[model samples]
Target: MNIYFNCMKGIVYKELIRFIKQKSRFFSALVRPLLWLFIFSVGFKTALGLAITPPYETYITYETYIVPGLVGMVLLFNGMQSSLTMIFDREMGSMKILLSSYINRNYLLFCKMFATSIVSTIQAITFLLIAKWYGVDISFLAIVITIPVIIISSIILNAFALFLSSVIKQLENFATVMNFVIFPMFFLSSALYPLWKIKDSSILLFEISSYNPFTYIVEAIRFSLYLKFDIQVFLILGISLVITLIMAFVGFKSKKVNHG
Candidate 1:
C-alpha cells in the first residue's frame, strides 16, 4: 500500500512539475476553449439560438449552451496532448525503463492516468473560473460539485488517450492521428451544437452524436454544472471509463510484449 501510494505521489508530482514548466500547454489549453467561447459563440448566437435544453431550464444564449462542450474540448485536447507526450517518452526509452521497473504495470499506468487527469482537471477548473469571470452562469457551488465530475471525465479521456498512445508508435505520426481523431470527434459530437439541432439538420449526425461517448461526457458535466444529474449520462460515462481503462491496459501490455 505504501509503495503504491509513494509511486502515485512521485508520478503526480512529476506531471505537475512538467505542466508548470511548460507554460505554453497551460495557456494553449485555455486559449482553445476561450476562442470558442468568446468568438464562435458570439458569431453563432443569432444564427443558432438555443431552445430550452434539458440541463437548462429556460432558453439560454449560445454562449451558455456551449460552455460545457468547451469544457469537454479542454479535456479532449489535453488527453490527446498527454498521449503525445507518452509517445515521446516511449520513443526516448523512458517509458520502457519505468514499465520494466516491475511495480505492477496496471497500477503504474493508473498512476500516470491519474497524474494527467489531475493536470487536465486543474486546467478545466481554471477555465471554468475564467468563464465565470467572463459572465457565464456558473455558481460557486456548481463549480465545487463539478470538481469530481471533471476528474472522472479527465480520467476517462486520459485512459482513451493512453490507449491511443500505446497503439501509436511514433511522435511524428501522432500529430496526423491526433488531427484525424480530435477534429472529427469534436465537430461531430454535441460539443459545438446540441443534439436536437443536429437532429434537425441531419439524422445521421444526430445518431452518431447520440452514440458518442464524448457527448455523454459533455452532458454529464453540463447537468452537473446546473446542479442536476442524469442516470443515463452517468451510465454511459461509467461504461466508457471501464472500457477505455481496459483497452488502455491491454494496449500497453501488448506493446510492451512486442517491444520486449
Candidate 2:
C-alpha cells in the first residue's frame, strides 16, 4: 500500500511540476475558457433566448443558462489537451523515464489523471467565480455540490486522452482524431443549449445529444449549480469513467509490451 501510494504521489508531483513550469501553457488553458465565459457569452446573451427549464424558475439569459456547460467545456478540453501533451512526451522519449521508474505504471497514469483533473477543476471554479461576478445566480452551496461532478468529468475526459495516446502512432494523427471526435461531441451536446431546444431544431440531434456523455456532464453541472441532483448525469459519468479507465489500462499494457 505504501508503494502504491508513493507511485501515485510521484506521478501527481511530476504532472503538477510540468504544468507549473510551463506557465504559458497553463495560462493558455485558462484563457480560452475565460474568453468563452466573458466575451462570447456576453455577446450572445441577447441573441440566445432561454425557456423555463428544471432548476430554473423563469426565463434566463443564454449566458446564465450556459455557465455549467462552459465549466464542462473547460474541464473537457483541458483534460484532452493534457493528454495530447502526454502523447508528445511519449514521442519525444521523455515518457520513457516515467515508464521505467520504480512506480507502477497504472498508478502513475492515475496520478497524472488526478493531477490534470485537479487543475481542470480549479479552472472551472475560476470560471464559475467570473460568472458570478457577471451576475449569474450561483449560491455557495451550488458551487460546493458541483466539485465532484467536475472531478469525475475530468477523469472521463483524461481517460479518453490516455486511450487516444496509446493507440495513435503519431502526434499529427491525434489532431485529426480531436477534430473528428471532440468538436462534434461538444457542439452537438446540450452544452450551449438545453435538450428541449435541440429537439425543437431536430429530433435526431436531440437523440444524439442525449447519448453524448458530455450532455450528461453539462446536465450534471446544470443541476448541481441549482442545488439539484441529476441521476442521468451520475450514470453517464460513472459509465464513462469505467470505460475510459479500462481503455487507459489497455494502453498502458500495450506500451509495456512494446517497451519490453
Q: What is the TM-score of each candidate against the true structure?
A: 0.97, 0.91
Query: Lowest-scoring 10 consecutive residues by lDDT in candidate 1?
Result: 251-260
Which window of 10 residues has the lowest lDDT sum in candidate 2?
A: 251-260
What C-alpha lDDT do the candidate models reach, one value each? 0.90, 0.81
Segments of candidate 1 deviating more than 4 angstroms:
257-260
Q: After superposition, how far is residue 200 of candidate 1 from its true place, in Å?
A: 0.9
Q: What's model 2's lDDT at 145?
A: 81
Cα lDDT tens digits for candidate 2, 7-67: 7777677777876788876667668667877788877777777778787888888778888
Top candidate by lDDT: 1
Could you tell me which residue pairs clash in candidate 1? none
The sequence of per-residue lDDT tens digits that candidate 1 reaches over residues 102-176 is: 588889999999999999999999999999998999999999998899989999999999999987866788889
lDDT score for candidate 1 against the true structure = 0.90
What is candidate 1's CA lDDT for residue 219? 92
